[model samples]
Target: MAHYKAADSKREQFRRYLEKSGVLDTLTKALLLTSKDVVLVALYEEPEKPNSALDFLKHHLGASAPENPEIEALRLEVAEMKEKYEAVLEENKKLKTKLAQYEPPQEEKRDE
Candidate 1:
């Protein structure tokens, strides 16, 4: 069934994520790989409702969840940097507008 295949695919994806997260040691990684194959077999036998592999991984891994901490830190840093950059840009724009306003306009040339 399509559902069975999707579940199997999700299990494989979770295994890959476990490997990629870099939080697992060799023993744990190997165990997870083995468990993934077992899960695939179980799902093929009896498929369950579709669930987000990312969410499942995040829940299981807790503090070791991929990208949460790092992303939060980067987001904060980016927000601060963007705020500073925008302030400078706004100031520059205001100065340019003031300069243009103060510049004297040329008079129209008289016809010969």
Candidate 2:
């Protein structure tokens, strides 16, 4: 019975130490519910810490989670624009090649 009591006391002491060290603060936990970018930055900047608000935000929000529908729509529009741009670039290359083939080469003059 005494051995069990000693073990329980040790566990309680550890829990108190964690809380006092701000290892489980509310803001840190709330950040977890917000975004992952914050978490990644924290991880890179504070490699030694076991807990980071940034990581909590990232873990809860996920790194790839889009914040708004408008942003997502804009991303899709940008991708479509890039595809169109690539097609135009290909066409331009072909047109330039054809033009070069049709043009006559200039003759170089020799110095007397």
Whole-model lDDT per candidate = 0.60, 0.62
On a 0 to 100 scale, what is the lDDT of residue 11 in model 1? 74
In order of appearance, the predictions have TM-scores of 0.40, 0.43
Name the 10 consecutive residues with the lowest summed lDDT in model 2: 103-112
Query: How many residue pairs clash per model?
Result: 0, 6
For residues 1-112, write the lDDT of model 2, one tens digit per residue.
9999997896676456445655446335655543434544554355354554434444555654656989989999999999999999999999999998886655422322
lDDT of 1 by residue, 1-112 (tens): 9999998898776567545644234335445666555544443344442354433433443435567788899999999999999999999999998997776654523322
Give all candidate RMSDs, comma-separated.
10.7, 10.7
> How far is 78's C-alpha from truth in model 1 (Å)?
0.5
For model 2, the superposed segments whose C-alpha errors exceed 4 Å read 1-55, 59-66, 108-112
